[model samples]
Target: MANYKPDLSCQNKFISVNFSEQIQLGTFEYALYYIVENKLDLSGSYAWYDKTGAVTYPPSGMLKIILLGYAHGLISSRRIARLTKQVFTL
Candidate 1:
Protein backbone atom coordinates (compact mmCIF):
# COMPACT_ATOMS: atom_id res chain seq x y z
CA MET A 1 0.00 0.00 0.00
CA ALA A 2 1.14 3.55 -0.70
CA ASN A 3 1.95 5.77 2.23
CA TYR A 4 0.04 9.07 2.23
CA LYS A 5 0.01 12.27 4.18
CA PRO A 6 -2.83 12.47 6.68
CA ASP A 7 -6.12 13.84 5.48
CA LEU A 8 -6.59 17.22 7.15
CA SER A 9 -10.15 17.88 6.04
CA CYS A 10 -11.49 17.62 9.57
CA GLN A 11 -8.63 19.26 11.39
CA ASN A 12 -9.71 22.10 13.62
CA LYS A 13 -8.04 25.49 13.47
CA PHE A 14 -8.83 29.14 14.14
CA ILE A 15 -11.49 28.92 11.44
CA SER A 16 -13.19 25.56 11.54
CA VAL A 17 -14.84 24.14 8.49
CA ASN A 18 -16.66 20.89 7.88
CA PHE A 19 -15.37 20.07 4.42
CA SER A 20 -18.21 17.66 3.74
CA GLU A 21 -20.73 20.39 4.38
CA GLN A 22 -18.82 22.75 2.12
CA ILE A 23 -19.27 20.49 -0.89
CA GLN A 24 -22.93 20.08 -1.54
CA LEU A 25 -24.45 16.88 -2.97
CA GLY A 26 -25.07 17.87 -6.59
CA THR A 27 -22.16 20.21 -7.28
CA PHE A 28 -19.34 19.51 -9.73
CA GLU A 29 -16.79 19.71 -6.93
CA TYR A 30 -18.67 17.02 -5.05
CA ALA A 31 -18.85 14.79 -8.08
CA LEU A 32 -15.16 15.23 -8.83
CA TYR A 33 -14.15 14.53 -5.25
CA TYR A 34 -16.31 11.41 -5.17
CA ILE A 35 -15.04 10.02 -8.45
CA VAL A 36 -11.39 10.59 -7.61
CA GLU A 37 -11.65 9.24 -4.07
CA ASN A 38 -13.89 6.26 -4.86
CA LYS A 39 -13.65 5.35 -8.53
CA LEU A 40 -10.19 6.19 -9.82
CA ASP A 41 -7.34 3.68 -9.58
CA LEU A 42 -4.33 5.81 -8.68
CA SER A 43 -1.86 3.03 -7.96
CA GLY A 44 0.14 4.07 -10.99
CA SER A 45 1.11 7.31 -9.22
CA TYR A 46 2.95 5.34 -6.54
CA ALA A 47 5.03 3.32 -8.96
CA TRP A 48 7.65 6.06 -9.27
CA TYR A 49 8.04 6.56 -5.54
CA ASP A 50 10.38 4.58 -3.34
CA LYS A 51 8.60 3.75 -0.08
CA THR A 52 11.84 4.35 1.83
CA GLY A 53 11.38 8.07 1.24
CA ALA A 54 9.02 10.44 3.03
CA VAL A 55 5.27 9.98 2.86
CA THR A 56 3.77 11.68 -0.17
CA TYR A 57 0.63 13.74 -0.62
CA PRO A 58 -2.26 11.60 -1.81
CA PRO A 59 -2.60 11.47 -5.59
CA SER A 60 -6.33 11.87 -5.30
CA GLY A 61 -5.87 15.08 -3.39
CA MET A 62 -3.37 16.38 -5.90
CA LEU A 63 -5.60 15.41 -8.81
CA LYS A 64 -8.58 17.10 -7.23
CA ILE A 65 -6.63 20.33 -6.77
CA ILE A 66 -5.34 20.30 -10.31
CA LEU A 67 -8.68 19.46 -11.82
CA LEU A 68 -10.41 22.13 -9.80
CA GLY A 69 -7.84 24.63 -10.97
CA TYR A 70 -8.43 23.62 -14.58
CA ALA A 71 -12.16 23.84 -14.10
CA HIS A 72 -11.71 27.43 -12.98
CA GLY A 73 -9.69 28.21 -16.15
CA LEU A 74 -6.42 28.31 -14.27
CA ILE A 75 -3.72 26.64 -16.35
CA SER A 76 -0.68 28.44 -15.04
CA SER A 77 1.30 26.81 -12.26
CA ARG A 78 1.58 30.11 -10.39
CA ARG A 79 -2.19 30.61 -10.62
CA ILE A 80 -2.83 27.10 -9.38
CA ALA A 81 -0.48 27.65 -6.47
CA ARG A 82 -2.33 30.84 -5.69
CA LEU A 83 -5.63 29.03 -5.99
CA THR A 84 -4.55 26.39 -3.50
CA LYS A 85 -3.25 28.96 -1.05
CA GLN A 86 -5.86 31.68 -1.44
CA VAL A 87 -9.15 30.07 -2.37
CA PHE A 88 -10.98 28.44 0.52
CA THR A 89 -14.51 27.98 -0.80
CA LEU A 90 -14.73 27.37 -4.54
Candidate 2:
Protein backbone atom coordinates (compact mmCIF):
# COMPACT_ATOMS: atom_id res chain seq x y z
CA MET A 1 0.00 0.00 0.00
CA ALA A 2 1.13 3.52 -0.72
CA ASN A 3 0.50 6.52 1.51
CA TYR A 4 -1.93 8.98 -0.01
CA LYS A 5 -3.28 12.29 1.14
CA PRO A 6 -5.58 14.65 -0.68
CA ASP A 7 -4.50 18.15 -1.60
CA LEU A 8 -7.19 20.67 -0.60
CA SER A 9 -5.45 23.97 -1.34
CA CYS A 10 -6.94 24.62 -4.77
CA GLN A 11 -10.17 22.72 -4.18
CA ASN A 12 -11.79 25.45 -2.11
CA LYS A 13 -10.62 28.40 -4.17
CA PHE A 14 -13.18 30.11 -6.38
CA ILE A 15 -12.77 32.64 -9.16
CA SER A 16 -15.67 34.80 -10.25
CA VAL A 17 -15.94 36.28 -13.70
CA ASN A 18 -18.89 37.01 -15.98
CA PHE A 19 -18.91 34.60 -18.90
CA SER A 20 -21.41 36.77 -20.77
CA GLU A 21 -18.89 39.59 -20.86
CA GLN A 22 -16.21 37.27 -22.18
CA ILE A 23 -18.37 36.04 -25.08
CA GLN A 24 -18.03 38.07 -28.24
CA LEU A 25 -21.25 39.55 -29.57
CA GLY A 26 -20.91 37.75 -32.89
CA THR A 27 -20.24 34.28 -31.52
CA PHE A 28 -22.36 31.37 -32.74
CA GLU A 29 -23.97 30.72 -29.36
CA TYR A 30 -24.94 34.36 -29.00
CA ALA A 31 -26.33 34.52 -32.49
CA LEU A 32 -28.25 31.30 -32.02
CA TYR A 33 -29.76 32.47 -28.77
CA TYR A 34 -30.73 35.76 -30.35
CA ILE A 35 -32.32 34.16 -33.40
CA VAL A 36 -34.22 31.57 -31.39
CA GLU A 37 -35.50 34.22 -29.01
CA ASN A 38 -36.40 36.97 -31.51
CA LYS A 39 -36.63 35.61 -35.03
CA LEU A 40 -38.08 32.10 -34.70
CA ASP A 41 -41.62 32.44 -33.44
CA LEU A 42 -42.77 29.48 -31.34
CA SER A 43 -46.08 30.93 -30.21
CA GLY A 44 -48.07 28.26 -31.98
CA SER A 45 -46.26 25.48 -30.15
CA TYR A 46 -47.58 26.43 -26.71
CA ALA A 47 -51.04 25.39 -25.59
CA TRP A 48 -53.39 27.98 -24.11
CA TYR A 49 -55.07 25.15 -22.31
CA ASP A 50 -57.13 24.12 -19.38
CA LYS A 51 -55.38 23.22 -16.13
CA THR A 52 -51.61 22.74 -16.11
CA GLY A 53 -51.40 25.60 -13.57
CA ALA A 54 -48.38 27.69 -14.58
CA VAL A 55 -45.37 27.32 -16.82
CA THR A 56 -42.15 28.96 -15.75
CA TYR A 57 -39.90 28.65 -18.81
CA PRO A 58 -40.68 29.70 -22.33
CA PRO A 59 -40.68 27.03 -25.07
CA SER A 60 -38.30 28.98 -27.30
CA GLY A 61 -35.61 29.26 -24.62
CA MET A 62 -35.85 25.58 -23.78
CA LEU A 63 -35.70 24.69 -27.46
CA LYS A 64 -32.59 26.82 -27.90
CA ILE A 65 -30.79 25.05 -25.06
CA ILE A 66 -31.87 21.64 -26.29
CA LEU A 67 -30.80 22.49 -29.82
CA LEU A 68 -27.42 23.63 -28.57
CA GLY A 69 -26.97 20.34 -26.75
CA TYR A 70 -28.00 18.41 -29.86
CA ALA A 71 -25.46 20.35 -31.90
CA HIS A 72 -22.74 19.08 -29.55
CA GLY A 73 -24.01 15.46 -29.80
CA LEU A 74 -25.53 15.43 -26.32
CA ILE A 75 -28.59 13.42 -27.30
CA SER A 76 -29.78 12.26 -23.89
CA SER A 77 -32.04 14.43 -21.77
CA ARG A 78 -29.83 14.14 -18.66
CA ARG A 79 -26.73 15.24 -20.54
CA ILE A 80 -28.60 18.12 -22.11
CA ALA A 81 -29.82 19.30 -18.69
CA ARG A 82 -26.30 19.13 -17.29
CA LEU A 83 -24.84 20.98 -20.28
CA THR A 84 -27.54 23.62 -20.13
CA LYS A 85 -26.76 24.39 -16.52
CA GLN A 86 -23.03 24.46 -17.21
CA VAL A 87 -23.44 26.69 -20.25
CA PHE A 88 -25.78 29.12 -18.49
CA THR A 89 -23.53 29.46 -15.47
CA LEU A 90 -20.54 30.32 -17.60
Candidate 3:
Protein backbone atom coordinates (compact mmCIF):
# COMPACT_ATOMS: atom_id res chain seq x y z
CA MET A 1 0.00 0.00 0.00
CA ALA A 2 1.10 3.56 -0.46
CA ASN A 3 2.24 5.30 2.71
CA TYR A 4 -0.35 8.06 2.41
CA LYS A 5 -3.94 8.69 1.46
CA PRO A 6 -4.21 11.89 -0.55
CA ASP A 7 -7.96 12.47 -0.32
CA LEU A 8 -8.34 12.76 3.49
CA SER A 9 -6.46 16.00 3.77
CA CYS A 10 -9.03 17.60 1.47
CA GLN A 11 -11.57 17.95 4.34
CA ASN A 12 -9.70 20.63 6.24
CA LYS A 13 -10.88 24.23 6.67
CA PHE A 14 -9.28 25.36 3.42
CA ILE A 15 -8.97 24.27 -0.16
CA SER A 16 -8.33 26.03 -3.43
CA VAL A 17 -10.89 26.07 -6.23
CA ASN A 18 -10.12 27.46 -9.63
CA PHE A 19 -12.90 27.64 -12.19
CA SER A 20 -12.26 27.86 -15.89
CA GLU A 21 -14.54 29.87 -18.16
CA GLN A 22 -16.84 26.90 -18.68
CA ILE A 23 -17.54 26.44 -14.95
CA GLN A 24 -17.77 28.75 -11.95
CA LEU A 25 -18.26 27.57 -8.36
CA GLY A 26 -16.69 27.30 -4.90
CA THR A 27 -14.51 24.46 -3.70
CA PHE A 28 -17.10 22.09 -2.28
CA GLU A 29 -19.47 22.53 -5.16
CA TYR A 30 -16.63 22.48 -7.60
CA ALA A 31 -15.31 19.32 -6.05
CA LEU A 32 -18.74 17.79 -6.53
CA TYR A 33 -18.69 18.87 -10.13
CA TYR A 34 -15.29 17.30 -10.62
CA ILE A 35 -16.45 14.06 -9.05
CA VAL A 36 -19.46 13.89 -11.33
CA GLU A 37 -17.59 14.99 -14.43
CA ASN A 38 -15.18 12.09 -13.92
CA LYS A 39 -17.74 9.35 -14.22
CA LEU A 40 -17.73 6.17 -12.12
CA ASP A 41 -16.71 2.83 -13.54
CA LEU A 42 -19.83 1.26 -14.98
CA SER A 43 -18.39 -2.21 -14.50
CA GLY A 44 -17.70 -1.79 -10.80
CA SER A 45 -21.13 -0.45 -9.91
CA TYR A 46 -22.85 -3.79 -10.51
CA ALA A 47 -25.94 -3.33 -8.37
CA TRP A 48 -26.99 -0.25 -10.27
CA TYR A 49 -26.26 -1.84 -13.58
CA ASP A 50 -27.25 -5.47 -13.09
CA LYS A 51 -29.89 -5.58 -10.41
CA THR A 52 -31.60 -2.28 -10.96
CA GLY A 53 -31.23 -2.58 -14.71
CA ALA A 54 -31.07 1.16 -14.80
CA VAL A 55 -29.13 1.97 -17.88
CA THR A 56 -28.93 5.66 -17.44
CA TYR A 57 -26.87 8.35 -15.83
CA PRO A 58 -26.74 8.27 -12.06
CA PRO A 59 -28.64 10.98 -10.27
CA SER A 60 -26.44 13.98 -10.92
CA GLY A 61 -27.37 16.12 -7.91
CA MET A 62 -27.24 13.29 -5.40
CA LEU A 63 -24.21 11.68 -6.92
CA LYS A 64 -22.36 14.97 -6.92
CA ILE A 65 -22.70 15.32 -3.14
CA ILE A 66 -21.73 11.73 -2.47
CA LEU A 67 -18.76 12.08 -4.75
CA LEU A 68 -17.70 15.33 -3.14
CA GLY A 69 -17.79 13.70 0.31
CA TYR A 70 -15.74 10.82 -1.02
CA ALA A 71 -13.29 13.33 -2.47
CA HIS A 72 -12.95 14.72 1.07
CA GLY A 73 -12.59 11.12 2.31
CA LEU A 74 -15.91 11.24 4.09
CA ILE A 75 -17.17 7.67 3.77
CA SER A 76 -20.19 7.92 6.00
CA SER A 77 -23.34 7.48 3.96
CA ARG A 78 -25.49 9.60 6.31
CA ARG A 79 -22.98 12.40 6.32
CA ILE A 80 -22.78 12.34 2.57
CA ALA A 81 -26.56 12.52 2.31
CA ARG A 82 -26.75 15.27 4.91
CA LEU A 83 -24.11 17.41 3.30
CA THR A 84 -25.81 16.86 -0.03
CA LYS A 85 -28.95 18.40 1.38
CA GLN A 86 -27.17 21.18 3.24
CA VAL A 87 -24.92 22.32 0.42
CA PHE A 88 -26.72 21.60 -2.84
CA THR A 89 -30.41 22.10 -3.48
CA LEU A 90 -32.62 22.13 -6.49
Each prediction's whole-model lDDT (CA):
0.81, 0.62, 0.51
Ranking by TM-score: 1, 2, 3
- Per-residue alpha-carbon lDDT of candidate 1 for residues 21-71, written as tens digits (9 for 90 to 100): 789899999999999988988878867666666788877788999998899
Per-residue lDDT over 1-90 for candidate 3, one digit per residue giving the tens place of the 0 to 100 score: 112223322343343432233355665665556655575543334243433332443444446656667878999998887876674232
**Candidate 2 minimal-lDDT segment of 10 residues:** 1-10
User: Any runs in candidate 3 off by more than 4 Å, and if so which?
Assistant: 1-58, 88-90
lDDT of 2 by residue, 1-90 (tens): 112233222342343544445546888788877788689866675553323554345566568778878887889999899876785455
How are the candidates ranked when ordered by lDDT, highest leading? Answer: 1, 2, 3
Candidate 2 differs from the real structure by a C-alpha RMSD in angstroms, to one decimal, of: 14.1
Quote each prediction's TM-score: 0.81, 0.59, 0.36
Pairs of colliding residues, candidate 2: none
What lDDT is obtained when candidate 1 is compared to the true structure? 0.81
Error of 1 at 86 (Å): 2.2
**Which RMSD values do the candidates have, in order?**
2.7, 14.1, 12.9
